[model samples]
Target: MNPSPPLAPGLPVLGNALRMMGDVQQFLVDTYRQMGPVYRVRALNQAFVIMAGERANRFLLERGDEVFSSEVSFGGLNSEFGMRVHVLRGRPHRHLRKVLATGLSRDLLAARWDDVTAATERELAQWRGQRALPVVDRCQRLAAAQLSVAFTGANSAARFATLRSAFELVLDVTIAGKWPAAALKLPAYRRARAEILAFARSCLAERAAHPTGGPADLLDRANEAKDENGNPYPLEVRAGMALQGYFAGINTVAYLYSFMMYALARHPDVRARVLAEVDAAYDGDRLDFERLRGLPALHGLVLETLRVYPPAPGSARTVLEDFDFEGFRIERGKRVLVATSVPHQLAEHFPEPELFDIDRDFAAGRRASVYAPFSVGSHTCLGAGMTEVLAVATVAMMVRRLTVTAPDRPLRITATPGPNPGRRFAVTVAGRPKI
Candidate 1:
């Protein structure tokens, strides 16, 4: 057996927990800096090896899916959402993945463009007289509005709001981990979870009574889907899928929209370039989906934002069997955490990685393995197409309606599990005539 690499020293009892709790990303980055590309840390009775850089990211993402498993990484989620047979590995997982992919197809996303644009316009109009909006909250509402219309139907606006609020509670608690988990047993968390579950079940019941006839919403489709054995997924399976989709789509979209807007506000030159592109593309009417996709600069801007501030900072996997890497052994059953932020900052893949350059031209025909924003391989984000659509639509709509100016003080960001600008960002919007 190959020998293991040196493990990072840790405090007794708490191990590295306190160090990680201080500033998680920085702690991980610092550990990587000291221990090289791979190092192990013990925290809360669990030991995890963190791998950094592009090459290491590729190896972990590609190989780990087959050998290691997301079962442990996603354990917290599974506990919260319940172990839906559909979301687990094997044939059921494949069937559900295929069904979910159908909703995010290019054609389907194009069909939903009207819903997205309409939501954006309506939300922006509400902000007409407002100044210094808490961009995170506003963006979450906006994303919820769009996702509700696209996933469920236009009538789900109120329900989506409730769901969004519930998810925010869940996310806030989960981000706090052990502390919040204990606290969550209190009345508020129970009430929120119960209400959200009830709302989801009610929606499912309504859909069952009256089908959309056309392509049904994801919840309805999953409920109606039959495997090769010709058995419909159980209700818990349906609920699990719905909850997963809700959490997956809403939070990430909100963060991306807020960050992109904040980035534009801070960088006027980039904003101007984006606006010019959008203006040139407009045909005196609605923004065409095809035209939006054609804007590589806008795409690059979104990509760069993700590279700089990835939503899921790290991914975890448990090694199923012993593996040798660069003359070191990774023992079986050991957990490995791949630091996504580190690879995104590596100079080898992204020179001058700190600078935000939308015209970088790094993404064109580049190997998919290099980028880990949405990750790579089987478990890559299913909402990727939807995210792109939302990002472009959000940026385009904001640019068309307002000239965003940064606040007196630069916005501070909290690099929690997801990156969000601190509580408030002040921006002034100079309006333009409606199209």
Candidate 2:
């Protein structure tokens, strides 16, 4: 076997793990600057080949089946969570994605707009009399409420705290790295896992008991769906899917919403433009799905937010077999992480990548392969359409309902490992004056 490439030097066994822990994005940018697109890095005594740049990202996301596989990359997930949908690949993978796509199509999403709008309005009403509300927390609750309505037709405000806790537990476990194995092995991890699974099971049971065929939520639809082989998805599989769906939908939507509000507060010009677009699109009333879709500037703003602060900064793929890319041999079984941060900011793909210009023509059609906030290929995010709708609605509602002003200090973005904002902003929202 060809020897693995050398990593940029680091201390002892820990390697560059400490630096990565401090700030993953900046660490990656530094690495790319030093070693170019493809280099090696060591973490937890494991040597991983790191790749960046547009071509590298394309190869990692698109060529997973032939050259690499998510199964290999996300092995830790299976070992911890026991072969959930996120770890499935090959034919089984294709089947699961198809079933998910059926429920998340554009028409189905359009049909569900009323549920989303109602939930958003309900949540916003609670924030009316409060000062110094944690914007991140508020956005999270709003997104969770909308997701609950879409996922299970349940009222989320009462259960938001529990659901949010469960979701955070799962996320914490997944991103713990190798050091937290002891803690994860303890009853805490197991208990959290049990809580999430138990919640899913109850939801599945309820959906099974009342199987609504016409315009039902995600759970109801999944309960009705069956594979070509006539096999219904197992309860565990369904639960896993539900858990993953909530995780995918809630965190990113909330963060993007907060960022949009922050941008509106800071940039009056952009705020005025967004407000004008919302007014023209909806005539200062409820946001219909069709109207939201027609607002191109709103769409551009959300995309730009994602480009600057992707929910998941990097993605990993493990080589299933020896593959040669541009003359470098990637050995089998070695993990390869593609830092998506720098590539999305590449000048070749996005001109003046630093500037937050929503009007930049990202692409003529929706299928901008290079713009991968939802990722691409088989493992692409199943809830992309739903997420986009939720974000657009949340931003539009805030723009229409209140005038947001930033705090006295510049907004401090707490860069958690995920794209979550660490420090919540306190926005002062006054009632919109009559136009």
Candidate 3:
């Protein structure tokens, strides 16, 4: 058997823990570059084996199901947020994914396009009298608006307000495993989980009460989906699916939309091209799915934004079976940190990787195994198609109806929950007249 992966340089007992304290993604990338494909590092008491780089990422993505167990790895999140698609394995995972697909699938993104646009317009309506507004917060509001209406028929900001903050609390405790297990039992966590569960159940009840009207929402679709044996999922299962679809897509899309807007603001050349393309694609006031899919400049801008400012970059997995990667042995049941985005930052995949240029061709990266903005393999994001539609359509709508401008300065980014524009990353937004 091949020997274990080499150990990374670290201090006495703490190991590489101190280094990871600041910018976890950066630390992962830098470590992969220095230590090669596979290596080990410790955080205070526990040592985690990290497999990354281009070759390693491809291997993990192609064979992840055989060797890595997401359900075991994300146990903390599962216990806190309850079982969702991200925490299920094998057939159960695929079954729930099918239920989630009832709402998040590509076909629905077009059929339910009105719902998405309505949410955008509603949130944009609220931003009429605002300036220098923290775009991240507003983006979160926008995302919550779409996800809320899409998951349930509810679109009121006041109703989503509590669910938004409660879900944020859930991520805080479980995102990076920063807190100990006892933290899960805190009054704050208890309250947060209760609020989230309560929100899901209330939406389910409301949908059951008035199931006949409006566009088909996630709850409606999930409720109609049958299991492998042709039986409808139970209430608890449906609730979890809705919660997963609703809460899972919010922050990622929020961060993405915020960055896409900022990328437009910060780069004038790209902005001009995107504006021209969006203007040409509109058939009067409507943008059909066909035209939406055909905007190369806007599509490039979205892809570039994800390449540089990926929200949910790396995923943690527990090794399910012993495997050798790049001549290093990964033992079963040990938690492994997979740096899925390492390739995005690598010059080999994206030339001048740090620069945010929408002009770069992503064909090669797509052909290779380098790009994974929505993650990779079986657990790839269910809302990816919707996310694209949201980014493309919302940006186009804002460009048409809202005067949005950010400071001609560098963006201040943070990665607590995920990479986000700082609170001060505000834009000047106001209503614009349409011709």
Candidate 4:
């Protein structure tokens, strides 16, 4: 068999771990340049083929389950989070996915637009009154609260609030690996998991008690969903799905929301144009899905933000069989990563890739397919449509109701649950007009 892609040179024993941890995006970029699309880098004491570019991404994401194992790739997360929705494959995955789809359906999200808008407005209102705080932290908390309400109805706010820090700790563990993860799993993390289970059990009980009287929410959708044989999902499965969706949704969308707003504040002229669109869409009164949908600038801004700052920048898959990938003979059981951020920055794919321009026409041609921020195919983000709506609504409301300016201190990207501001940076917000 042809040798696996060239192994990246690294320090004795440690391999490329330091480089990978130092600056993951840059390491991927630099390695791709020196070694081309396929190369091997070691992390956590194991070697993985680092695959870059849109073609590689499409290959891994689209046809992954056929030859690459999601369970093997994502199973590490289960140590802390339990059997999350992403870890399943084959029939079980399909069944869980079907249930999740119903809850995150466009119809459901549209029906819940009022809650989304109200959440955005409430967060912005708080920001307007505050003197200073890390906008990223505040945005994350807002996203968690909003998603909690959407998932389990209004009563879930306090429970979700309690779970947020523990959720953060879990994310840390998932990224840090077995030893570090084990060491970090303190009482707080256990408490958080217990609280989540308790809250989920309560939701299950609530759904059973009022099968029809309660307001429609994610739990209701999960309760009503069926497996391949038409059996409703077990309470444990439903609860797991709810918790999984909450963790993924809040973490990714929260950073994205802050990033988009950060972009708007950094670019005043673009902000002015976007705010104009938001105001025009609002017309005089309430903001609904119809109005929000019509705001082209806001939609463009959201897309632009995702392209620049994908929350899940890289996705991994474990090879199930020996295979030829791009003329390289990859062996069975080897893990490979589809380095999305590399292609996202390729000069050919996006000219002057570093520039943040909202006017980029992403709807047509290669740009559309090339942009895989939320990934594509079977593992594509289920909440994509909802996230787009929330990102637009939240940013638009912030701009329309308040003037947001970036702090003098540069905001550096760092991983909290995902890539976010290295430290909390103040974004000054003052009233624009009473909404």
Which candidate should be chosen as best, given lDDT against the real structure?
3
Per-prediction TM-score, please?
0.87, 0.88, 0.90, 0.91
**Cα error of candidate 4 at position 294, Å:** 1.1
**Candidate with the greatest TM-score versus the true structure:** 4
The local distance difference test score of model 3 is 0.76
User: What ranges in model 4 sit over 4 Å off?
Assistant: 10-15, 44-46, 76-84, 175-181, 212-216, 365-368, 408-410, 433-435
Instruction: Assess each prediction's global lDDT (C-alpha) against the native.
Output: 0.69, 0.68, 0.76, 0.71
* Per-residue alpha-carbon lDDT of candidate 2 for residues 273-303, written as tens digits (9 for 90 to 100): 8888888877546676778778777887888
Cα displacement (angstroms), candidate 3, residue 336, comes to 1.0
lDDT pick, better of 1 and 4? 4
Tens digits of per-residue lDDT for model 4 on 129-188? 566757777877788777766665553456656667666665555543423556445786
TM-score of 3: 0.90
Candidate 3: segments with Cα more than 4 A from true spot: 10-22, 44-46, 213-216, 229-232, 430-435
All-Cα superposition RMSD per candidate: 3.1, 3.0, 2.6, 2.6
Backbone clashes under 3 angstroms, per model: 0, 0, 0, 0
